[model samples]
Target: MSRRNPSRNGKRSTLKDEGMQGDPHAISSSFSSIAVSPRTPKAAHRMGLDDETEDVELRLLGEDERQQAANGLDVEEQSGHSTHSLSNEDKRAMVLLCVLYLIQGVPLGLALGSIPFILREHLSYSQLATFALSGYPYSLKLLWSPIVDSVFFVSIGRRKSWIIPMQIIVGTIMLYLSLNVQVLMDDPSNHVTQLTFLFTSLVFFSATQDIAVDGWALTLLSPESLSYASTCQTIGLNTGFFASFTVFLAFNSEAFATKWGVPHLTLSAYLKFWFVMSYAVSFWLLFFKKEKKEPLSDVDMSIKAVYKTIWTICKLRHVQLLVIMHLFAKVGFAANEAATSLKMVEKGFLREDLAIAVLIDFPFQITGGWLAANWSRGDYPLRPWLFAFWPRIGFAIIATLIVYWFPKPPITMGFFVFLIIHTVVSSFTSTVQFVGISAFHTRISDPLIGGTYMTLLNTFTNLGGTWPKYFVLKGVDMFTVASCKLQDGGSELVVKATECVSDHGKAACAEIGGDCITETDGYYMVSGLCMAFGVAFLVLYIMPTARKLQGLPISAWRVKMSDS
Candidate 1:
């Protein structure tokens, strides 16, 4: 009693004389004294309380009570000591999950990214406009993530609720996308022709599934397990994206070949074979029942309440700024993405070559990813970080815009520049973005509510990228009328008259040594300049954001190479 109850008298209760122990929750001796009084006391009790105390401790109680008491103690001990832990099986399952997710990226990237090439070869769509479509979903996924977060058909069990079903659906959709490419090409003008909507639906579904997979792992595993799981998933997801898009391009290209008969018949055949293997994945899901989840988080419950909490978080200044930066940063990106394929086609690359080059570029990107992963590990100053963010983006925008001025498609030169630039910019930006995200993650420490916040961040990020793309496209369409009214090639005049070119110090439509301006048009140059300005904007805003993160004062104009 003294040990379990810790009486105020500072005395220990000996269990030897008492065959059965008192309940841990039992009252102290002083309380017992208050209950019984001095008149009732007897020295025979171990605590000098007499026979009554002894009687209470002794035995009409058989093995059952003793067992129950022991069980009670065990329960207490367990409740007291319980903590997050993971078995070896958990590690293995996580690895497998990462692999599946990563692999899923491969096909998805191929399907979405190769569209510009596909449009160019088969449908005669503008390469620039088609290219913009490639990165559409990722930049827009945030818009629907909340809906994805809110509902669940499989509410119980470890793997059954969301993970297994989502995988099955994604696989099915991927197969469908594969099968429908030809259907898309059959009538390019048809809204449903290429199954773009279907493809988008799959992207949304897959992103949700990804979140669930992440939540499942985050909730079930110990903190120690979190890092490895996250890394595996990240690395794998990137790898999968590479494989699906780059590695699988040959098949994608073959699907569009005239010899393949029916627009996408070849791809459909391949998808049928690929999706069949998904059946074996059931075994992985079967045992997921053993894994358990509580409510959605270490913090926050009730969907409405969580939404309200998120609303509150949205008011934070830094968060708002980050969202703005993320959004604006991508407006330029959208413009560039839309224009890149056109640039490629003009440079003389076919769909097959584009695919091949992308495949070849994957290793370099992976290297970039690795280096980024490593480089983002340490402390950095805000000024340098801010400085670092802008220059590369500036270069990219400028380089791309300048390329618009080229006389020919400039394929080989542009590809080499793009491949190298992609590697560097991707690495630098990804590393910085992840740092900001990591900071955000730290501020919001609840594991359960993480999905919602992450989704929110992703949504803002998507809005950032998507809105810009639309703006650029709209601007292009709006300006095209004014942009046109000029011929692709110019009139060729002898310009034997020195003053034949006296129109505002510029040559007129007179066919002199070529309309003098036919080699590169002013409209394309304007578009290029706009892109360059956007790049400059990215550098200016992001560089400051980086500096703010590094905690360097604004007055300090120092550039630290140690960071770079």
Candidate 2:
């Protein structure tokens, strides 16, 4: 007769039914008997059981053991703490997510950074403003984020269903645009409608893909490993930016044409390459990558529930404050960013020079992200945001000074050195601030509605960073000493030169060429505006908010999902 043993769940099991328990050498075949109570209140309630009374069985010994072994988690209860360690699957997840993030950065770098320089000569300040506005979809992605969160093709994996299709659409658009690049470059004014249509569609599809990627990241990373999310984003996005901004520009640059035996590559060729890369990566992910098949309970896929969740997060007091801060934080930098490239080109800086400067500054951006992630982990987690904002404010002032005083025409070696230093320091400050802010957003965001919540906050942040560019571009004409409306019939020809006289006390405006005649009144105005806002932000928002929020628990922020 076999003896019976009682389980913690109050079920009696015979030794004969499971395995012989008395043999010292017999490893308990009742390993399957080991059960896990729900670690979360939501999970407990969803299953209609209390944490103490739940009978969750571990079905597969090998997989569970591998996870625990990889992460070094003890079977012994530790009361709600999970120390992060990278399993093989977690490593694969990071690589895939990082690559996807890099892909997202490509269009952004071109639309926001590179193309402005490419079209600088052909477009007016107002037209440039229109170009900048083409990126507005990024800031408004939250509106359709719910669809991304809820709708899915279960056959092709939940997130991939969104990501793969969007990538294909993006590639097709880029292919068409690439083929039309030369025609548009030849007659930009006439092609404005076509250019706007294609670019705008690109932005829309890219933003939708971003929503899916953000939601996918939530499913891919456990809470313990979440801090690394910002690092992945920083590195990956910057890498893509490097490709779009530096590599693309380098090939198109005069220096590369002069030195290399190879001819300068056309913008169309670059775009074709971009299309191929996007499609290749998408196809590889589609065939090779495997998303962990989670139960539907992992995410509340109900559309109503997602909207309700988004509303709840929005209503939280702390969340409101954070959103406002993010919205306002970059107001100082917005106009500065939009006008600087044009201004630099006007001052005789070549495309190659700016490309090289960005290349040199890239390493510092990666370092800043790494440091921010490590520093944000211990005591006073929010301290990095508070500390970083001040240096950035100072850098903004320095940048403003650079714009104001640099002499018109003939950029000297000394001036180039100054520009390089400014670029490096600015990149460092911006990266630190970005990493801190991103981590803060990730920490506060509920994984339950990751797509909507993250995009909502990012939209506000981008609004602060980008919208001011529209006004800055508009205002550039305000302090103009002279204006020339260049007509595109077959060649660049000045149709009319209005206000040919100097306004900002420059000598011989009609003689002195380029954007110097524009007088930088817009840049000066934005600089002063940023300084004022930075001071107010520091005294009114950051100081008090950081002091209050730094040491407190996450739940204290009032954004914690009740079920999660």
Candidate 3:
């Protein structure tokens, strides 16, 4: 039989010469002449070649081929140590990913960070709980993520098909909101429901965009650059969040604007600005960015198959444990993360001052994320996540103390400095934990179902934080015991605030020269309980499970599809 020589593409080689099979030297020489390139040891092993077979294969290679193989091995060895190095293409992909993530963060920042603080004064804790619902779309995105992954316009590109449309919808919603958000906030008591529904829709579109971008991210950069995906996400989201929350809050605060002698910004103007920015970015992506089509694979890409894959992945014991970990991991920090800042605002802390603290904390957050990416790049990616757990809970405790001891408005410079230090330290640790977990997720995520897999994991992480927040907010109001002090004629009477649940009742209490007094602040109690849960959960569940999960082989995290 005649075979084409791989080394000399057009040359015909005879493999059936008499005695060729019996003569080992002749066979090796013949194989060497036909060989193209050497397989990596890993590839050889995966092909079921034993060490003896690999040695034989190596010995069969021609001298020049052997030298080429040696050089390839050297390059790979050097690359192992230089993962930080990125090609120009990688850098561009990183920039593109960061921009996309940053765009997602803008609306999220305004809804979750800025609006909550703005409405805290006008709305009660219960009403704020409704606004908190807007955050759920993100946490619940996993439900629809499979559809995003499985269904798309192949011509428009899998990721771009969703990203383009979602961003356009986001821009439209922002434009609509820019026209009405201020009016809604002006009478928050009467319009809280409408405001909640509006922002919820905005957040929903943003979450859908996140799923597509996440999938695209897996393919956008080279495998070596994959570790930076989480870092880009952290930096980008935080920057957008910084702009919408810290910058916007600082400018929107009349007190801050006057104090700094800067032009004041209104919510309407801010929303309008983001609307324009969103549209601009969306258009840039639609026209300039071209998504590379994914190659066909054995695994089905249909919607049913994608969802079945999700189910199969969920059925894995390790995944179930990880999901459980994601669901309850944030319980300890819930009250502190969700309520502490708003409580401080209620305690007379200026919104602008709070903004300043976040502004200072921002750099550390980015730095921490970068550091975490390095720490998580190793085999034990969850190490940093576990290490930061206790420190985060401790920070929560410290935050509680700070909130309790917070002095009245016009905070002293010393106190402000203390708050900033606390904010920076706490935020740094939190960022580390977030990035560490995210890096691990990126490490384990199956690229074939990148969108659904990443979204499923991220959904649980977000839910862990999101689900607890609403309860914590409600718990604060539920646990709080307050009274109104009223002077009737020459006698002073105290009426329970709980009895004044309605607007008319509250108005009546205020009309009778009543002053609200908190006999028992729920913030302290709720924070204490959250901390306790966090500590117990860490000691009992997280540490042990995390170690096991991190120790698992990459194959364990991947889908085990049949060859058939």
Best by lDDT: 3
Mark the 10 consecutive residues where model 1 has the least summed lDDT. Answer: 24-33
Give Cα-based local distance difference scores for all models.
0.44, 0.59, 0.70
- Per-residue lDDT tens digits for candidate 3, residues 356-464, read 9889877776666566656765557789889999888999999898888889878899999999998888877776777667657755655334455666777777788
Clashing residue pair totals per candidate (backbone < 3 A): 27, 0, 0
Top candidate (TM-score)? 3
| Comparing 1 and 3 on lDDT, the stronger one | 3
Worst 10 residues of 2 by lDDT: 20-29
Better of 2 and 3 by TM-score: 3
Residue runs of model 1 more than 4 Å from their true location after superposition: 1-87, 103-107, 122-159, 177-180, 191-194, 254-265, 277-279, 287-289, 295-300, 378-388, 398-402, 405-448, 473-541, 549-564
Give the CA lDDT, 0 to 100, for residue 530 in model 1. Answer: 56
TM-score of each: 0.63, 0.76, 0.83
User: How well is each residue in 432-487 modelled by candidate 1, as lDDT tens digits?
Assistant: 44433333332222222345555566566555645554445444433332111234
Tens digit of lDDT per residue, candidate 2, span 1-564?
Answer: 111111212111110011000000000001111111112223222321223212221221245533543243233124223454677766777787778877777777777667878777666666667777777777777778777756776777767888998988888888998988888877675666677667778878877887777656655765445434444555566677677877778778867778876578778887888799789988987998777544433233356655666676666555677677766766666656778667767556788778878888777666665766556543355677678777777777777677667677667788888888888887666665655555454444333333455566666766667667788776765555444434356565442344332222122232444332343355576557767877887788767865654433332222223231
Candidate 2 vs candidate 3: the lDDT winner is: 3
Q: Which residue segments of model 3 deviate by more than 4 Å?
A: 1-85, 499-508, 562-564
C-alpha displacement of 559 in model 1, angstroms? 35
